[model samples]
Target: MKILVVDDEEDVKSLFEQKFRKEIRNAQFEFSFAFSGEEALTYLADHPSEVVMILSDINMPGMSGIELLKSIRKDYPAAPPQVMMITAYGDSQNHNQAMQLGADDFLTKPVNFIELKEKLLKTL
Candidate 1:
């Protein structure tokens, strides 16, 4: 599966690469990184039907993940890519908002790789 990971943190790319190294080596998941929500939109625009899922950080600098989620839901209402929002703050307000905006799932940061892998497998 092709997954787009969006976050403001530059280290996120390396972290994901390290965490999912085995799956990547096995060709189970293909990942693309975007440093910002705007960049994620650009990537999505360029590769409309390529991405199967998006893992986005909710508290970004410019456009927040909630805003990104809203835009994606609005733009691709028919067949939107599955979106899972991640955040350091596990507040109900953020979680509720994301759920209302059509988020497929919500994950709290310091993410549990084991849980994430299980969820990804379920999707497959």
Candidate 2:
């Protein structure tokens, strides 16, 4: 499965790389990273059908995850890729907005990879 992960934090690339090392090595999961929502959008334009899921951070510097989710839903309304929004704050407002925007799932920051893996499995 191919998953595109978007976050402003550069270290997120390394974190996911390390956490999913076994899956990557075994070719069970392939991940791509984007440091901003615009970057993620550019990537989507290049590989529209490649990504199976998107894991995005809600509090990005530009183009928040909610905006990205809205765009994705609008652009791919037929069968959009599953989106899972992540945020450091577990506030109800963000959660509610993400759901209202059509997020498939929501996750809090300091993410638990085990839980994330389980969720990913179900999503796939």
Candidate 3:
């Protein structure tokens, strides 16, 4: 599966790379990235078919994950990528907003690798 990870943190990217590089090397998966929501949308516009899933950080500089999700649902309605919103905050408001904006899942920050793995596996 091809997965896009949208986050502002370099460390987060490195973490994901650490966990999935073997899968990528073995041809089990491919990884892509975007530092901001706008960048994520641009990548999607150019490679829509190549993207199957999106794991996005909620707090971004310009556009937030919820905004990104709404845009994806609006412009790519037919085959919108499955979005998993990740945030440091675990409040009900964010969770509701994410779901209402069309996120397929919501994951709180300090993310558990095991839970994330299960979620990705199920979605894939």
The clash count of every prediction, one per candidate, is 0, 0, 0
Span of ten consecutive residues with least summed lDDT in model 3: 20-29
| Clashes (candidate 2) | 0
Question: TM-score of every model?
Answer: 0.97, 0.96, 0.94
Cα lDDT, model 1, residue 108: 99
lDDT of 1 by residue, 1-124 (tens): 9999999999999999999999999999999999999999999999988899999999999999999999999888777899999999999999999999999999998999999999997887
Candidate 2 off by > 4 Å: none
Model 2 vs. true fold: TM = 0.96
Q: Candidate 2's residue-wise lDDT over 1-124, tens digit each?
A: 9999999999999999999999899998899999999999999999978899999999989799999998899888775899999999999998999999899899997898999998887876
Which candidate would rank higher by lDDT, 1 or 3? 1
Error of model 1, residue 112, in angstroms: 0.6
Better structure of 2 and 3 per TM-score: 2
Pairs of colliding residues, candidate 3? none
